[model samples]
Each structure stands twice: as structure tokens, then as C-alpha cells.
Target: MTMDWCPGIREACAHWQNATMLQHTFDALQMALESDSDASIDAVKGLVECICRVIIDQLDDPTSPLKPKDEASITEWVSAAIRVLGRGDVRDRKFADLIKHHNGLAESLRVLRNDAGPFSHGKDGFIQALTIYHRRAAILAADALVTFLYKAYLDSQLDPISSREPWERFAEGNALIDAHVGLVVDDDDSTTLRFILPSGDELPINIEVSRLLYQLDREAYVEALNAARGAQKPAQVREQGEH
Candidate 1:
């Protein structure tokens, strides 16, 4: 039931002074979840709207043709954010298609919010109330969209040098190293060294503990090991003397 992306989203919003608003919205959502009310649906929609507006306002590129108007819909804001983060790269068909799909999803969420959200519109007739399952679905969708857009925004802020991995930067600095190498750290803490190919593919090799050790400064590594042993010797001697 936890929003795993809340911390990162709060961190991102901190710069814009939207942390208080985000917290209030989250608190309202939590209350709705506990009450099992349709207000959870409204909160989900409001959360997305809030994040989309933040992104549209802060990350909009003036030169980009995809920029949204001053009074744009939630879907338009989402699309504008995506376009700005993606650099309006229409050349990448895969990226274009993905953006299209995401924009559609945003639009669908907007429609759902209007139709199912109790507080969105006043109606004389009785409306069908959304169950916990619907709330969960909406929450998951909003989480995915907001997380993806925010991550893209953060990545777009990185410079070329900062975007490259450390070893890639080292390789770029070294004239003798003809190949560009990158490192990927897995969730389980295992490391893989990848040779980045010209076609953008990678040849990955799992780095063992011994190999990783040798990758560091050999002299410093040995000195640290000796220092550890030297320190342990005093403890061992003290134990024997005490015995």
C-alpha cells in the first residue's frame, strides 16, 4: 500500500517549494485509502495533476514546439513534460511510440478522474462508487507515470560528463583506451563491466570479488590488508596474554 516513489518525488519537488502541497495530497490519499472511499480516486488524479503542473512549469523548453499553453489540461502537461525531457527527438520512432502510448494513458486517467471521481463534478443522479481495486489501479498508474516523467526530468538535467559512468569518463580521458566501457550495478550489489559497442549494444562480463580487488590500486590494497592484519595481531597477543 506504500507509495515507493514518494521519497524521490518529494526530493524532486523540494526545489520548487511544493513539498507541503505534495505532503497534504499524500495525507489526503492515505485517509481515503483507510476509509475505502472514492476520494482515493480523486486524490490519485490530483496527485498526477500536481506533479504534471510542476514539471510543465519548471522543465518547459521555450524553443520546443511541444510546449503547453498557460492553461493546459493534465494530458497536455504530461505530454509537454515528456517532450521536454526527451528533447523532442522525433527521429527515435521507438521513443515517439512510447510517448504516444504514455500520453494516451494520461488522457485516459484524466477521463477516469472526471467520470469516477466523486468530488470532480456534481451530479443529481447517483454515480457508481469506485472500489479499492479501482483505487489501487489508478494509484499504480499514477505512480508509474509520475516516476517515469520525474526520472526523465532528472536525467535531462545531467550534463554529458555527469551522465557517463565513472569508468566511461576515465576511458574518455585516456587516449590509449580505444574502447568505451561502462559499469552497471545490479540490485543485488553485483557489478557488471560492459563494453559499449558502436551499435549501442553491450558486451557484459560479471566481475568477481578477486578481479574487483585487483581493479583498485594494488599497493594501496596490499597496504590496507597488511594494516588490518597488523591491527589484529595486537588483539590476538592481548587475548593470549590474558589467557
Candidate 2:
């Protein structure tokens, strides 16, 4: 059975960059930020439009377990993909929440794309402001879906290989234990553990490792996804300043 799938989802959101991330609209945002380059704004606009147009494209990405299919509505594609990747595995409803929450994010992305498209070519300062806001909004929405894909990838790996197809990349996980003991607990009572491999993958504790770990180790595994890890971790700031 899946051992606390909610932790994986939390890890995916907290440490999203550790996964194979999508730069979706950031490449365009970078161009918009450049003041001197004549090609920057146009490039940004082009990239933003591409993201807008591809909302319903195939979810057959390397990070996705979905097989190639006819282009589907983004919600339809995600629903199918999640169902295949252990829709009933979680007892806590965390995975179900993510599936439901994604539609809102997709709508946000579409709105940003439509609202920002025209301003991308405008020279007026206020237009640039709207363009920047909308484009960034697009990125924020797209980022949620990107993180969910990573979470889904993790979930797919947890399922029995015989039930999954070969093209889904359902194979053995390669996480090697680099440290036998690691722990970090936050104020919210969530724990983080370092199950790093030599290849730099800080994976959550899968079932196999759970068998080998001591009770304390297993508890550490339970908390591993509560917060970010390493330099990607956010710094805590006080009321008026950073700590």
C-alpha cells in the first residue's frame, strides 16, 4: 500500500525545483524584464502565447506517466492521468484535493494568457504593467500544474509495475540511501529527512526503505516532505526583517 502519499505531494509543492521542472512562461518573463533588448518583449509575448495555445496539448511529457493520446482538454487529461496513477490510494483525500484544485489553476493560466497577449506588443507604461502582472500570473498558475505532474510521477512510481504500462516509465526506483539518519522538524510539527542518493536525489522514503529503517527512521520518513531541503529552502524572516 502507499505509505502516506500526502507527504509526497507536500514535498512536490515545497521543493518543486528538485523535480524536472517546466520553465513554461519564465523564459518570456525574463525577456520582459530586459530593458535594452529590442527583441525581449516580442520574445516574451511569443512564449506567453505558446503557453496559452498549448493548454490542451498532450500530457506525454517525460515527467508524466501518461501515454500519448489525442490532444485533450487539460482537465480531462489530468483527470484520466490521475485516475490511472492510483486515484484511490490515498485515504486522507490529499490526492483527491489536488485533482480537484487543478481546474482552478488551469482557468487562471488561460485568463492570464488571454489578458496579457495584447499588452505584450504595447509600448505604454501601464500596458507593460498589466502585461507583467498577467504573464507572471500565468506562470504562477502553470507552476501548480507542473508541481502536480511531479507529484503524479512520484505516485506512479509507487504503484505495482505489473499494473502499469511500459511506456509510463514504471520501473524500479533508484534511490540509494546516502545517510542512514537525518531529521528536521518544523513548528507545524512536520518533519524533514534527508534520504539523499549519490546522484543528488532527495527522495521520499518508499516502501522498500521503510522495511529497512528503524522505528525512528520510519518516523523521519513520515516528516520528510513537510518543508523544503538544502539551499532551495526558504529563509524565515521576522516581522520587519530576515532572520
Candidate 3:
């Protein structure tokens, strides 16, 4: 079935190994279309959270200390995915502000789900009835937010450099050394190439020194060595020796 609110959502998510979440979202959307109840609104909220979780799982670094907790809110999940997908673009102040706006929208959706969705909590008094218009608005908002984030995720996948962390990008650029050594950047901003010895001990080398020693081109290697030794030219070195 075609999802009119978010065109191409099915195709975009077709490659995912687990389709249960997407199926549930589709069912929820269908329910919303046929009913004018808060139950449908609750389902729309679930759809948004599902999409956010999927994006975060696919894009976030598994080993990062800052990974979101399992109990994170929908807004927190959205923010995590945004941080990954918006990496290269977040440097722009305007783009960063726009991301903040998107986070606000996610928070608003969460608020709507909590306040108006009957399935979320028991109410003491009579609540306002939601019309088909309310269902449509919820679907529209959820669809737009999910679609935007999914597009950004897909775009990041297409660009390898932008998708990788800083150290990974450096490793990818230096093909020869990348395979032989692991790149690491310390908290103090110092970069090192770590080589594992036969005894399994790590031998750390400064990045610049490693580059000079293992440069692929012979001429470039010589030039780097000469530059390190504070020599302008081979002739100048010989002349200085006479003095």
C-alpha cells in the first residue's frame, strides 16, 4: 500500500532485515486513516519512536561512551540520530539551529502523545475528543520528521568520508599504513599509530613521525626526512658541513 503522507517510506526502508517495525507502522497508519480516536494518535507516536530508534541503531558508534541509554526518550533518540547524520553539516550555525528546531518538533510530538493519547494514561475527567483532523495532523508531523531523518541517514551512507569518524577518515586516506596500524586519537588531541608487537604489546608512534618513516613515495619520504632535519637543500647541507 502507498503511504501518501510519507511517499517512498516503504522503498526506503525495504532493505532492513527486520520489517516488523515498519509493518506495525503501516498498520498504525492504516488504523489512523479509518478511525478518529486517541488510540491512533498513540500508534503514530510509536511509529515516530520506532523510526528514531532504527536510525540511531544504524548510525551510532557502538563503542562510544556517549551512546544513548535504552530508557532514553523519543526526543533523545531523535537527537542521537541527528548528531550522527548531521556531523559534517552541524558546523554551520544556521544548520545547528535548524537541528535544534527539529528536536523541538520531536519533543512536541512526544508531548502530544502523552497529553492526548488515551492509551498513554488514565484520565480523572472527561477528555476532549480527537477528530479525524487531529489524526491527520499527527500522521503528517510524524511522517515529515521520519522522512527527513531517513533521507539524512541515506545521504550519510553515500559519503564514506563524512560517514566515518575523524580517525577512520585519516586511516582511509593513508591506505598503506591503515592496514598495518590502528589509528588512535587521545583525549588530549594527540594522534598516534598503534602497532601490535608479536607479544601483543602495543607500540605507539606519533602520527607525523610515522608518516615520515612509512610514506609510500620514496622521494616524498626523503623530502620529509630532510625537512625534519631542518635542511633547505642537499647542496646547502653539504655547504654547511664545510663550515
Q: Give the top-scoring candidate (lDDT).
A: 1
User: Cα lDDT of all candidates, in order?
Assistant: 0.66, 0.42, 0.65
RMSD of 2: 18.4
Between candidates 1 and 3, the one scoring higher on TM-score is 3
C-alpha RMSD of each candidate structure in angstroms: 12.5, 18.4, 17.6
Q: After superposition, which runs of candidate 3 have C-alpha atoms over 4 Å from their true positions?
A: 8-17, 87-89, 122-126, 158-243
The residue-by-residue lDDT of candidate 3 on 138-205, one tens digit each, is: 66677777777877865665334433223343444457654555545556644665666445678887
- Pairs with steric clashes in candidate 2: 191-223
Candidates arranged by lDDT, highest first: 1, 3, 2
lDDT of 1: 0.66
User: Per-residue lDDT for 1-243 in model 1, tens only?
Assistant: 454424444444544454466667767877776777777767766777677666565555546556567667778777777766764576788877777777777787777777777676765214486666776777667767777777777555533443322344344345443655444555664666666765678887787645666677677668767887899999999999999
Give the 10-residue window scoring lowest on summed lDDT in candidate 2. 1-10
Error of 2 at 192 (Å): 47
What TM-score goes with each of the models?
0.54, 0.36, 0.56
Screening candidate 3 with a backbone cut-off below 3 angstroms (N, C-alpha, C), the clashing residue pairs are none
Superposing every Cα of model 3 onto the true structure, what RMSD results? Answer: 17.6
Instruction: Give the residue spans of candidate 2 off by over 4 A.
Output: 1-71, 87-91, 118-131, 158-243
